[model samples]
Target: MKNVLLVLFLSISMIIIYVFIPQQQSIVFQPNDSNANMAYIPTKEETQFKIKYTHSIHLTDVVESYKITPSKKIHQYELMYEDFSIGMPSNAEEGETFEVLNGSYYIKNMKRIFPFFHLRIGQVRANHTVIFKNVEYPLSHSIPPGTSVKVEIRTLNFIDLWKGVNILESL
Candidate 1:
């Protein structure tokens, strides 16, 4: 009887594990010390993106409190910047571009999101473009000094949605 029970438990455990686990791909960024930040905190109703600051900079008159509004399929939360990062890749200027493939972004030291692919940037500035998989986004923002800008990363996967927290200083 004990043998039969043990076999049954093992079978059940195997079935559960097979049905629940997702295949996750992990990649580490080079230089291995790029700074990233979450500019804002998400509210209960907000379910799309989270923001943070990669560096500690000053911002002015930025929106302190906000809520998620209506959307069609994807809701975009805009984090108006006061003072944004002036970070650029080696030799990159206010109008140059770069790319980081197989890149990994860690939020608040907990959740990790890896894109299927990446694209090169078209320009560089305090506010530049970040193109990934044909989707163009901003690299930096324009905000007031002493104020921080918020970044809005998608919250699609259910597991990654609830792990919102402030972005750390470095990735």
Candidate 2:
């Protein structure tokens, strides 16, 4: 009888612990560093061709959405043609200081130049509709002509929940 009673008590205690204890919640951001983790900012170079048309989309639509409060401060960064290439390099210089719209096209910067600049439209957390070039796309869609598109990022925090953590670290 004593053993049975002890087991019951322990089971109840464990249940209580599980119910009341809160999971650790963390805030993550993208482009973690302002300078693209580079040692110094590179000189701004002129582009050969004019930017014909630009369509912007928010990150929340492309990537898994997270809660963002209005009170959270937004940080801005700009990516120009010279800073990014086809494939992302290990040591790319992230530029500093630019005006970025919160709900717009999402683009990433890399050290080397590539043929196409990757772009994503729509985010899970997007509150309103995003109309680009007179057409409406789904909640999330990949933008084509990656070469012509420029990317700007606006976020409350730079740490991203999904892409921030290293896959190996979880293991």
Candidate 3:
């Protein structure tokens, strides 16, 4: 009788821990450390997100669009930049399209996939912006300067989401 009761108890505990507490998926910008205050949760969609930053030397805007696959891999689809100077890409690789539209250069049909990428917040000139859900956010507002944030998708529970940062409250 005691053995059966123990098994039941364990099963219930496991269900409560795994099922009772719901999990939410979001693109998390976690810094080098486990400092949740420095982290940012931009969106819950596993569809698309964008990172826009200004060139340090040229001071022109550069936008990179990424799509999150169903398997959680990040797929870079397009890149838009002001010009072709100061380390900017001149032409697209094999099968990619390089075109000019409205005085800007666009490299479309990108096929680069990565598990995750590190984004080091610029101390001086990099005005990095996170755009998703038709909104733009200033990344420098939450994280400290020069912090290398690991950008990835994380399945966070309520406690984790509460601890992490969310800059979309007003919207």
TM-scores vs. true structure, each candidate: 0.23, 0.23, 0.83
- Model 3 scores worst on lDDT over the 10 consecutive residues at 34-43
lDDT for 46 (candidate 1): 34
Candidate 3 off by > 4 Å: 1-22, 33-38
- Cα lDDT tens digits, model 3, 89-149, are 9999998999999999999999999888999888888878888776888787767777788
lDDT for each residue of candidate 2 in 1-171, tens digit (9 for 90 to 100) = 999999999999987666555332222112322322101111123111112112233122322111222332212222322122333222325542322245333333322333222223223333222222233333122221111222322221122322233211221
lDDT for 6 in candidate 2 is: 100
Candidate models: Cα lDDT each: 0.29, 0.28, 0.81
Taking all chains together, the TM-score of candidate 1 against the true structure is 0.23
lDDT measured at residue 68 in model 2 versus the true structure, 0 to 100: 20
